[model samples]
Target chain A: MSIHTLEVLVENEPGVLARVSGLFARRAYNIDTLVVGPTSNPEVSKMVIQVNLEGHSLEQVIAQLDKLISVISIEELVEGAKKPVKDTQPDYQN
Target chain B: MATTHVPTANGTVMNGATSLVKSLEAAHVDVMFGLPGGAILPAYDPIFDSTIRHILVRHEQGAGHAATGYAQVTGRAGVCIATSGPGATNLVTPLMDAGMDSVPLVAITGQVPSAAIGTDAFQEADIRGITMPFTKHNFLVTKADDIPRAIAEAFHIATSGRPGPVLVDIAKDALQTQTTFNWPAKIELAGYNPKIVPDNQSISDAAALIAQSKKPVFYVGGGVIKANAHKELAQLVELLGAPVVTTLMARGAFPDSHPLHLGMPGMHGTVAAVTALQKADLLITLGARFDDRVTGKLSTFAVNAKVIHADIDPAEINKNKFADVPVIGDLRETITALIPALKSALAKNSQDLAPWNASMQKLKSTYPLGYTLPDDGSLSPQAVIERIGKISGTETIFTAGVGQHQMWASQFISYEHPRTWLNSGGAGTMGYGVPAAMGAKVGAPDSTVWAIDGDGCFQMTNQELVTCALNNIPIKVAIINNESLGMVRQWQTLFYEGRYSNTSLESKRVPNFPMLAEAMGCVGLSCERPEDLDATIEKAMSINDQPVVVDFRVHRDAMVWPMVAAGTSNDEIMIARATAPDWDSQEL
Candidate 1:
């Protein structure tokens, strides 16, 4: 299994978030982390979803998500680029 | 802020409920199935003024299934309405069933007032949240002005692409408030554009594969019927001159009497059909999703075949199995394009597939569908279904609740046209027969609709018979009463060492179906003797003004033959239990 991040842009409408999350839930796909916020366009909302799944299952989940009527676009995030990093303490020895 | 309210051109200010009804009328929704309640009273108030005819169902579940039945018959989005809380929850089963089967339906429910939402007010429920997982899309209308657009979008989403149920939960206050209603000329759903035209390259590739293959099998599914591509599919099948196997949901998609038709393929499918699919080299799956039931032990199923999966839904293409060439678009359009492509590509080659055809024909004749009649005088379920098929002929729309009866109907009936058979294929929801039959009769008023139900399934949703009687829907219901959950009992008998656990229904305590039908204003008849079968069916067929119910008490131990037990490969199919033979080993 691999961890993949999908960035989805959807129409900013009521229940759009539910539609996205509900898609994952219905398929029984686990979501590691999900973050939603306003996009640059006021009419659209951006959702960053991280899921741990096999390649085939991830492809299916993405395809299913794309079929949603409210979903505008979807992009998978690369491993090293713009990853969310946790805060680290200063090393005393260094 | 000062604002002036402008009335519509007709000088009529419409409320949310009125606007919703008007939008349905604009969509040409002539019939609806629903039950009214407190929050949805406003919607019902305008029904009298609208041209839409509403059937008051006995229960919300019945209404939803009725809508699914209507959608399956008309190829349009069937509309249903319900009130808040329990009423909305009651629609969950049918919505999920519709979602699984890809039936087009639009369900509108009244929610608690906007101010009362989330307050746990009386009759308050988050219906949008509840139906989110199953519905294609759902809307929660907080404002009165959004009614028209929401209704239009719901209809569009429900009927387009991979069709399924869409829910619109309108707040009670929205229904009560007034607004200037203007029907939108076109829907503006930016993300919902379905690709109706197939990619030409993919079509040509599929056509080339079809033309070159020596042993090809066309695996069709409900999508063929859903897309109304029967004509195109039949043309392609005839062009390829290959055997065709229609899945359970696709029983009527292809004519059963066709020369190349190899009955259904699944757990209860014909041996020849299953054997052909398992051994075929090229599998051209048209709109079939390769469900687990159809693919027993998927790793070994069609291992020798290179699949050409053509489906309207792109998600279903590679969901279960890898597709060598995927044609993603509407089935009708894809098949229409592929037909000519195959004709041009296969014009020169006259590759004869005599040996394969001969082998299939041999298999078909060798182990034909058979069941033994009991010497005791009790009726066999298969015989009953076969007799019904013979009497009903090709024009009747036969529906079934899931069981041995459903398999028998699928095996025995000859469906000459599309949309003549409706059932819950994916969900296998019991109690679907009666309401679905009612909806089918309503959708095709001139056609004879039959609901062949098992006794176990009939008790689940038989209350819809009251709705049928009151609505003057003349549907025929034949209950195969085995006094047990026949399918489950058979499994238990085979796999569970003859231990029948809670499968037997206490028919003695339960009201007799014939008497119950009589109480519900339907003509009821009970047939027990095998000789009475033909006469009973003829008597039931004679009734045209009111609904009729015939209870046939079949033998409880009679099991469906040619069984391929779950998880077993198709090669392991058992015609029947082997018995000891008289020995003459000395001569051998």
Candidate 2:
């Protein structure tokens, strides 16, 4: 599988991220990299997620992300980029 | 659009169109579902000219539920507007439902002008404070200028973090003030920063632990679904060769078809998944709060595993079961770091779990999900759900209320796609199906939605039927009526001293739903005979103009199986009825 970066824009409000994250959690989707911060628009924020997914499922992720009420937009930045699966694994260090 | 000044007992006040419309537009409101009343007439004028669409609702509850339905399906903040007193109070049920389900909603209520606040004047109530605990944040717009900012902030707060409903109370006077309109560009809420980021050190430490473990498993929850991290989760699972067992809310986070997918592991979880969790060496929990339903008897849950809990909410960690490694940050960030950590840590004393995997495989085959079809020609509810799944396809959304129906749905319905099945998981709220189904249908107008509810749950918020009829929203309501609160009855029959009380609705004379539906301007179908089930459901599904409620008169004594008796472990589930003639014919 190839690594892809997903930049999601969401409404800045309560439980928005939780709902978004919960979607991925229940699906057992792991994040290779994730970066979240304020956007140029104060009413919105951006989340940068990196993962390895194939064709149809990648489209599925985009469709699901768009369904979230807080999510404004979703962009697939880097796709079909091969990264060593063993080299880049999701870590929970917070 | 001009304000009309009026003299009140306490002070001077004004009511006008420009003030109310300006604030709504400033708040970026695109639509509102409500009815107009004397107390809210000033605000109605602006709504007519503004770009925002105003949907006239038959009942205040419908306005609230419709907003909830819209918000839940769109994932956008939902807005509902209503007048004071009964209008405002009518919204309470839907608001509470939204709050309980964590749906982002901004509810606007009109009050008598500031001079008459809390004096019990015709349409006056202290709605702001009354709804404070139920919302993430709330505001009372006393000044016209404050109205714009309040609306803007309401949207921001309602949609941010762990999303929930927010109320904005505007007096009729506030809707009359005219000022140079400038919407606030930014919000600054002191001590409330909803953003989350991962700490690098914690990431490194978690990576080290993963590298050290020989047998590791992932315990996922609803948070992954919220973050849209299914691909990342799949990547990690494949990379680490880890098996994942999701909680109820976490359903569909992992592809059910994936080999490493252990399915839901909890009170009602599959036997293999639960057994695997019990013997796992390392537990990597993501986004899920380990609630009692999933943990079963906590002492025996994942007893052999060392836990690494990663959740956005810090309070969730160690709230129940203690974790050896705690990662409190955005789940997306934590997973990004964990991917590399686990990859590098591979090849550290791997244990051969082929035997264990084989044993789990055997358990799955031994206690497979099963139900009996009566030879006497009785229709099985499980079969009905399976039929719906087959005809509707995986993408068609299924919304359910709490009870035996929910369990049966979860068991029989195959959810291949994410977010296609919406149910009350954390708070198993009854009366959730009809409203949530209404909301889901509103969100995805293209898809056919089903409100698969039990008779007990349907009665709780059946008032939404009028909402469905008025809006012309066509949704199917499949009521699995066993003439009793089936779950409670099951418990009473098995262990509650065999004394069933108040569980039977038969004595009350089940509502004449067919007559009620016709009165409410919708088609209604009822079937007491088992043979009529399939054809009736097909008839209900074909209707496209208004909501359809099908009351399935099921056997009262029928009970959901594979039940973990009170105080029993997940291993000791009742797969079938005790009095069944044969074990094979009894349960699967």
Candidate 3:
């Protein structure tokens, strides 16, 4: 099984973390490392979850993660690749 | 700069409880099943003035199952309410059942004040934490102003995509506090959109596979019913002329009386359906997860088939088995797209599948569903169910409690329309039949609803019959009184040297079911002899003013046949214990 790192952007709401972790536990998939923190926007939280799964199973896990109501966006981070810098400013001003 | 004092246009303020009621009204929720308690008293205070109808259930579990039944029949998200601690804890079973079956339901619970939330206060429990694993989503609302938005989002999430239960926990303080009332609050959830459109490539791939295969089978499930795609599914089935096998959750998705229908396929499924799946080369699964019950000994199940799995939930596509073509979208949309593509592909080839169709028809007649009449003059549960199927025809909806009787009803009864069958297929909850029947009656109102229950199962939650009686809902209940846990006893006899441990419920020790029904203001009847069953069933059907209960004392030794023992290959199915060659020496 290959280990993959996924970065997920989610709404800052109660039980959102439990929901993300619960999805993995229900499928009996193991999470190697999980880190959660606030994003540049106070309303959003970012989670970096690392898990070991086969190529096909990992695709299913990612699709399920994308299906969560609290999750905003998900991106797969390449191993040993540099993390992207956070952008603090909005692209368009109201 | 934003001002702190925001005044309402009408210069009126209401408590969170009133806002909650108004929010429910805005969401078009008219009925709710619940039991109130200490933490939830504030919410119930507003119910007196609201238009929402509340049916006070005997237990919290009944409320949950009733909500599920209502949701399944109405095609809308059902609403259920309960208080904190034990009340919220009791709803766990129904929530899990809805999650597994993908029924749309919303559960509202009252919580302790925000201060007492973590202090182990009286009648306080972390319901949001408890239901997080099973629910589609959950909310813990501590502010009065968040009431309307939370309620709206709860309904939206519960009814959207692959629908399941969602929970919203309201702190008591929030309900007591006054805030400006909002009738139509904006839903601010940004991450909860469900995909409805199917990928063009996947649909084309599935169409091509269907057009080319000679031995193709359409395996359908509850998703079709949930999506209300039965018409589209029927169109596809007719277009291809492929034999269809509906799973337990999909009993009514395809009309059982149709010529190409092969019935249910599982552990207790018919031999024709099971054998056909084993021989099929192309299996088109619509909204059906490859559940263990349907696929015995997974490695050897559908061994010759290449699967094309389509479902709204992406997670279900490859969770249990590999899918050569995985189409993720609504069943209605996916089927609608694949139909034209398949028609065009068939026009070019026009391959003959008559040989396969003839073979399946031969199998159907060779091993038709059958049971022998006992000469001892006792009622057979199978015969009872078959008689009910004949009398009810296609008009009545049948809900069953899990066991041998459940399997018998599935085999004997023919469902002609969608949402005509409701059972705890995934959770296998014993007491699901009574409350579900009550909920189905409430939802349909015009249709006849029957609860086919077992003696052991009837004892679990028969108190719901009181709810039916009090509410003036006329649901008929048929309890197949076998005097023992027949399914477990059959297993013990077959696998455990007939130990019969704790499975027997002697009639002497148990309360008389007919008497209990009469005491609860219902028309109660009982049948002991085989000749009395027809008359008793007719009598029960005649009483349409109130709930009726008929207890049929069936033979304890009668077992469900065409059984594939757990964890064994489907090919090793036992047609009948007496008929098997070398039955005395062969290991099960």
Q: Pick the candidate with the highest DockQ.
A: 3
TM-score of each: 0.94, 0.77, 0.94
DockQ class, candidate 3: acceptable
How does each model score on lDDT? 0.85, 0.71, 0.86
lDDT of 2 at B578: 54
Per-residue alpha-carbon lDDT of model 3 for B1-588, expressed as tens digits?
111222132224889888888778778898999999988889999987888999999999999999988988899988899999999999999999998899999999999998898999999888888887778888999999988778888888888788999999999999999998764434556776566878788898889888889899999989999999999999999999989999999999999999999999989887778877877898899999999888899999988899999988877877788888888888999999999999998987766878888877777776788898877878888999999888877989899998988999899998999999999999898889998888888998888999999998888888998999999889999998899988999999999999999999985247788899999989989988888878888999899999999988888889898888899987777788835323343221
Two-way lDDT contest, 1 vs 2, winner: 1
Which stretches of model 1 miss by more than 4 angstroms? A79-94, B1-12, B348-350, B578-588
Cα lDDT of model 2 by residue, B1-588, tens digit: 112122121121323346556556655567677888877778888688878877777677767777876775666887888998889988887787777666789998888888888678987777765565456666777777676567767777787666779888888887776654545556755324453666666777777877667667788887776666677888887877767787666677787667777677776677656766776788889888777787777777777789888876544556578778878776777788788876765655345545555555566667667778766676667777677667667777888889888888877777666567777776677877887787677778888898888889888877777777877778888888777888888888887776898898871265877767677777888876766767887888789888888777666666676665555565554567553212343221
> Model 1: clashing residue pairs?
none
Candidate 1 per-residue lDDT, tens place, B1-588, comes to: 111222242225888788778777877799999999999889998887888999999999999999988888888888889999999999999999999899999999999999999999999999989988778888999888888778878887888888999999999999999987866666767677777888888998888888788888999999999999999999998887889999999998999899788888878788778888988888999989999889887877888889999888878867888988988889999999999999988995545667777777667766677888877868898899999999988999888999989888888888889999999999989988988999888999999999999999999999999999999998999999989999999999988999999999965347698999999989999998899999999999999999999998988888876776778676566677542111222110
Deviation (Å) of A62 in candidate 1:
1.1
- Please state the i-RMS of candidate 3: 8.4
- Second chain TM-score for model 2: 0.86
